[model samples]
Target: MDVTQSTAGDVIEVRPMTIHIGAELFGVDLAGSLTDEQVAAIRRALLRWKVVFFRDQALDHEAHVRLARHFGAPTPAHIVFGTNESHPEVYSIAKHRTAQNGRTSATRCWSGWHTDITAAINPPWASILRGVTVPPYGGDTQWTNLALAFARLSTPMQRFVEGLRAVHRFDAPAGDGDYARRVGARDLAAEHPLVTMHPETGEKVLYVSPGFVKEIVGLEPSESRALLENLWEHAVSTEFTVRFRWAPGSVAFWDNRATAHLAPVDIFATDFERQFYRVTLNGEVPVGVDGRPSTLLSGEPIEAQPA
Candidate 1:
């Protein structure tokens, strides 16, 4: 299934998922990419695929930021203080991505399943990831379709979680007792609705961040614990997921509102330098299927509009 490019410049061959997913667009240039219509078409395919992989398109930092802006508002850098100072929108996810690592704050070892920023009142709308340094045969990133995940949930389970809320906290005290020591003590935590509709697309999506979700709303301690554990088990199931193998100059973009991702830890050896800049798209207030305002979550809530 070939997707036609917008203009007469170049005909991009979109190999539409004979293998897997919506489409892999070929012959599209990344440096000065496609026209607005072409970009919109790709965006439509991205929403359909849940994740889109662009193989071998090279992009510099400026170009990277430019591509990110095409989607919407630029997301503030992930709150890793030392690493992401140069670009207001781009952030460092690894230990060394920051300018200063001497006093590195502890981050959680994210081996489990999760979304990027569910703790925020309104998490990111989308994410475009570039693999700067990939390992020989591993270090792939897996994305789970939360929209589908929600749609496919057993009716009983869906009803059980329908009106429930969850506590999302970033300042969940990073230490020996916590899940991992790499993430530092979070200074902010907040509550958010469990099920929300994407503000733009209005699709129902599961809204939970694995690392930040502390408890479920209106449930007792034990019930909340059991519910969280159960929902997590449901969220990480393999049937609703896909893993993308990365290559140099390759990038993947997905709607964070409707997806959850897990990054492989294979590239961490003694001498490996794994660094990538991340910028989230500013998200609108999420609404539920019923069209009510969803609760604002996150200890460090960013302003609704761009700062």
Candidate 2:
């Protein structure tokens, strides 16, 4: 699948990475400033593909921030993890060593499937990540199209979930290992619809994930757990996903509202260093098919501002 033309007349070559999720973009240099036509074309591709990849652009922190601004205002690094020293909007994901035994840790704390910042009332609309020090062999990231995930479910299941809502909390569950420790005491939570309508494309998306959703709002505890587990399993089926291997200078810009991504744990076991910089774009509050909006349980709203 490919999109070769845009209303702005800039020809962007989009090569589909998978039938369900991702596309690789060509004919645009992200390191330099982009024209309005190119930016429009890229945004169109992102809505169609859910996630888009670019290779060999070699964007530095400044260039990365500038590229993200073409789509939407970039949010601050993160309320918990903080920002890079020079760039306030850039969040560094550099993990070179583990504190225990001074050896490379065998497990990565972020190796779960999640949409970025779902604990917030309005999660990020998009996330742009640039590979700065990727390992040669491992650390591929996988994304599944949430819209596709919803579309594939049975009609009965779809009807049952479209009107429901779930709680998303930032605290990692017990025995989740390094992830739990790293997330210490952030205390963020929110309630979002089980099926969210895309603010731009009007597509319905499966909005639950194992990483953040704690319970279905109106169900009994046991029933909620069973139902959530079933939905989680269906959401990540391989048929709906695309895996992108990383290389130095490679970039992935994804629609957080329409997909969930997983960072593999294999890279931590290897001796190679893995680092990346991420910038999230501001998003509007999610609304259900019934027209109810997501409610914040705790935490302030994200302030959208250009980098």
Candidate 3:
């Protein structure tokens, strides 16, 4: 649905995506920025559609950072794990020219499909990324519907997963590597429910990923890994995937709870660096779909089912 009413000089285009997941709000100069009403409408659209895209829209770093605040408070990234040093809110994700100690290349490879920091004591709710570098041919990012992932599971699968719990450790499965090489940041592994419900939408979403997931509760490591791997494979199935090619000034924002995204660093040691500024919305702890309270094996608080 295109909103047609506009001043002659202010006319802008809104291109909603053909699929159910994305939309490109074009023509409007975000410089004037969206009005409160327009911003609210954009938010409503984002909720209805999981992700929103804007093409040929440009905003400086300050402007970009400011725009994200419209959604929620911005979380300044912790430096050791953070990408950008200049702007705390912005992360420089390029791999080249980094000092050997920086491990920039290793950090840049996080392009795999994952929601941000589900392992954190309090994970982020959403993230907005501005596309500054567009790959000539192959680099593109794909996000899958985890909310839909949980919904699409067979009833038995859903029931089975619902009863299970997972531990998302800051542990990196860096096979045959030293512990420091595995996860350089402060160790941050914690147990979480397998099936998480979105706090805002109240809908269930699959919450496991390869990045930080450590183990499943109740099951032995072997059985847990097998079951989780099975579910992770299901989460990335073709039917739920949405791919996007980047253009300069293009932007994307998505609900971190219900989606898993993979950024293919398709460009080999080429000079291309997919630079962007990302701002995260702070989030609370998560709860599973089955309404069982989430509990920490240690001191962290899991949710308790309501009366």
Predicted structure with the largest lDDT when compared to the true one? 2
lDDT of 2 at 211: 73
Worst lDDT window (10 residues) for model 2?
98-107
| Tens-digit lDDT string for candidate 2 (1-307) | 3634344486678889887789998989999878888888889899999999999987988899889888889998886556545888888887542212111121123227788889889999999999999888888999999999999999999999998999987764455455455555466789999999999999999998557787899999999978887888888899999999999999999999999998677766878888888989989999999999999998788887544
Candidate 3 vs. true structure, TM-score:
0.81
Runs in model 3 lying further than 4 Å from the true structure? 1-20, 78-80, 96-111, 172-182, 290-307
Q: What lDDT tens digits, residue by residue, belong to model 1 across residues 210-274?
A: 76677787889899877777676677677777877777788787788787887665565445555
TM-scores across all candidates?
0.82, 0.90, 0.81
Q: What would you estimate as the lDDT of candidate 3?
A: 0.65
Error of 3 at 203 (Å): 1.1
lDDT of each: 0.65, 0.83, 0.65
**TM-score head-to-head 2 vs 3, winner:** 2
Q: Is candidate 1 or candidate 3 better by TM-score?
A: 1
Candidate 2 TM-score to native: 0.90
Return the top candidate by TM-score.
Answer: 2
lDDT of residue 30 for candidate 3: 57
RMSD of each: 4.7, 3.9, 6.2
Report how far off residue 90 is in candidate 3 (Å): 1.2
